[model samples]
Structure formats: structure tokens, C-alpha cells
Target chain A: MACFLVPTTEAIVTTIATKIIEKKEKEAVSTELEQGVELSSLHRERFSVKLNRLNHLLWGGSLLLAFEHFWHGEIQPFFPFLTAAGNPADWAEALHEMSTVGVGMAVLVTCVWGVHTWVLDRIAQREGMAQHEEQARRAIRK
Target chain B: MTLLITILAAVVTSCIWYSSARARRLKTGVLCSMFWGASLMWLVDAVAEYIELGAAYFTPAAQDMLNDAFLGFSVIVLALTVWVVLLFVKDPDGVVRSALHNQRS
Candidate 1:
């Protein structure tokens, strides 16, 4: 649950926030330049492309993890809580195991994905600032 | 049953990933994440069952197997519905906006 929810929440928040921030920045830059400079579509396009790539990486990584677990026989075929066992004791045991191991794995995966997104966001921010500085310098020179 | 669930989730996730990759968009990222999450959830469930059942895990009652299949299908449908809602809200391409404007005009 965490694996899915964490990334989905992060993506939605970041994507919307980034869009808002970009719009504000564009407006500010435009006012400052007084139409002397036009915002380059390239930077926006690059950001979009980079974000898409990151999404792909996250998806692919998760898929690979699932496959690896499956290969290791760590994943078998059984539904615990949903199925009633012949022995009530067995059902209780299954529930206990799931709550512990299942929850732990979900938390672990969510944290890893959160860290990945943070690192990627930082890189994108740094690159974006650098590009803006270069553009400013070029404008001054011109 | 858990294995089948995992496989089904994987297949859907892959399809979404492939389409998103071709379009070079992250619009379906949420959907992929949801399915992957569900897959992982089921994977852990499977492991626990195997641990409990040991060798007997391979042989499940026919009725129980059917119930599991129903549960798996329910999960897939739920995930798909959630994804569709997210996509509608996001409206990345502004199609919704365009349609609204056209209607008003």
C-alpha cells in the first residue's frame, strides 16, 4: 500500500506544484524582461522529458523487484485474511505474519521511493537554475 | 491464487508502462504505482501463506481458489477505477478544459 500510495501522492503533489511554480516564474521573468526575451520552450520540454524518464525508472524498478521476489519463492499463492482456514488458529497465525512482514515491506519500499524522488527533484532544480543563469548571462552579453 | 493476482497486476502495470513510455508522459504513473503496490501486497501475502502451509500450499481447495480469483479481479477493477479518477482530475492535456469551452461557446 505504501509503495503505491507514497509515489502516487508524491507525483501528484510535485507535478501540480511544479506546474504552478513554473507559471509564476515565467510571469516574473517576462515582466522583468519587458518582452525583450521570450521564455524558451526547450527548458519546459526538457523538464517534462526528464520527469517522464523518472516515472519509467520507478515503474521498471518496482516491476523488477516484484519479479525478483517471485523468482526467490518469497512470493507464493495464498490469500490469508480473505480466506477462512479450517483451523481458527492457523488463520490467526497468518494474520499475524502478514501484519508484521507485509506492512514492513510496504513501508520499506515507500521510503526508498520517497528518497529516489527527492534526489531526482534536487537534480532537476540544480540543472534548471544553471540553465537559467546561462540564459541570463547570454542575454546580458547580447 | 496470490501468484495469479501478482501476474495479472504485473501484466497491467507493464502495459501502462509501455504506453506511457511511448507517449513520453508520466500521466499513467499513478496507475502503474497502484498496480505495483497491489502486486507487492499480494506477494507478501503469498509468502506468509507458504510459510504457514509449507508443502501443502500448492494444493488449495477448489472453492478457496475461486474465491481468491474473485478477490484478485476485484482488486484490479478497483485500481483501474482509481486511476481513471486520477487521470480525470489531472487532465494533463487540457482536453477537459477544451471540451468545457466548446460546450460554453
Candidate 2:
């Protein structure tokens, strides 16, 4: 009944991590600027941005699932929050579901995001290589 | 049955997202992830039910099946609503911005 909680937990962790990494990214960018690095050449997507994407996916899915659970009356706006948490037997079932379904969803979303990140990285690398080649050609012509 | 419906939606949305640039621009990937997550949850629930009920799991009451179908459709509708809101906020093509700019002028 509380399968959404797993991803919600993940979302919270990622959200905090995103904020921390974003601050670090800002500091790093400022330092690079102080070292005379061109901001235009700092075109790579920040890790925090990638983490934010995963956070978005997790939070969005968890929100919809939580809404669905509430719609089905599996969730309550009261103490314990989950209808299944009222009794020991049902609480055990809820835990089982959380361990299985909830964990499965969290893992699946992470795997998909991992693949998407890899693809994005590949695209960025190719574009960077192409830009370097173009600059080299212009230099030769000059 | 609900699991099947959600899985089907996830697969269809993923295919659309992969094949269409506009769908990607609109962030259909978000919808895909939602559907996929729900589908996996339901799949696990189904397996648990099957284990507990054996052959009876395959013979759910018609009313239960109907209710499950409605829940499945409702989940899809809710996901679409959320995705629409995201698109409006993002305004990928600057559609809302342009409309507002035109109105102001």
C-alpha cells in the first residue's frame, strides 16, 4: 500500500544531493572564471542537473502513485497514514510490498535514468569532438 | 488486468517518446517513467496475489476487474494531466510566452 514511499524516499535524498551539488557547481564555475576559463567553453551539463533529472522522474512518479493510492483509499490523511498500517498482519503485507514492488520501481527508474545519462553524455562528447575538428580546420585555413 | 493496462501504456508511451521529436520536446519521458513505475508496482502486486490465490487469481470477479480497469484509466488520465501541466510551465516552444507577449502588445 505504501510502495510510493520507497521512491519518495529516494526523491528526498536526491533533492538534498542536488542542492548540495548545485552549490558546489557554482563555486567551481566561479573558480574557473577567476582562472580565466571562458564560460562558453564550459558547455558540459553539470552533474547536479543530471541528478535533478532523476529527482524529477522519481518525484513525479511518486506523486502520481501516492495520488492513486489515496484515490483507492489505501492512504489516509491521519496517523500512520497508510490504511494497511493499522494492523500487524496488514503492516507486514505493506512492508512486503514495499520491499518488492517499491524497491523494484526505484531500481527500474534508476536504471532508465542511468541509460538516459549515458546517451546524453555520448551526444555531448560527439558534439564536442565535432566542434574541436571544426576549430582545427579553421586554424589550418588561417 | 490493471497491471497489463499500465504496462501497455508505458510501452506505448515509450515508443512514442523514442520515435517522435515533438514528444521528446514535450517531455513524454516523464509520462513514460510514471507509467513504468506504476506498471512495475502493479506487476509485483499481481505476482503476490497470484501466489496467495493460485488459480483464483486468474479468475477475478467481473466487478473487481471493472474497478481495476477504471483505476488503470484514471492513472493514465492523471499522468497526462501532470504532463500537460509540465508542458505549460516549461513552454518548450515559447507558445505561452508568445501568447502573453502578443496580448500585452
Top TM-score model: 2
lDDT of 1 by residue, A1-142 (tens): 1122333344455557557766766676667578565555434443444444444433433444334344344444564312324457755754565467545545544565557667877887789899889999999999
On residues B1-105, what C-alpha lDDT tens digit does candidate 1 reach at each position?
Answer: 745775677676778678666432545666665556555555665676688899898899999888767666666666567666766787777778899999999
Stretches off by above 4 angstroms in model 1 are A1-99, A107-142, B19-26
| Model 2, runs deviating above 4 Å | A38-41, A78-80, A119-142, B47-59, B97-105
Spell out the clash pairs found in candidate 2: none
In terms of lDDT, the best-performing candidate is 2
lDDT of 2 by residue, B1-105 (tens): 667888889999999999999999989988887787666556656776788899999998999899888987888888889889989999999999999999999
Candidate 2: TM-score, chain B only: 0.94
Which docking band does candidate 1 fall into? incorrect
What are the per-model DockQ values? 0.07, 0.36
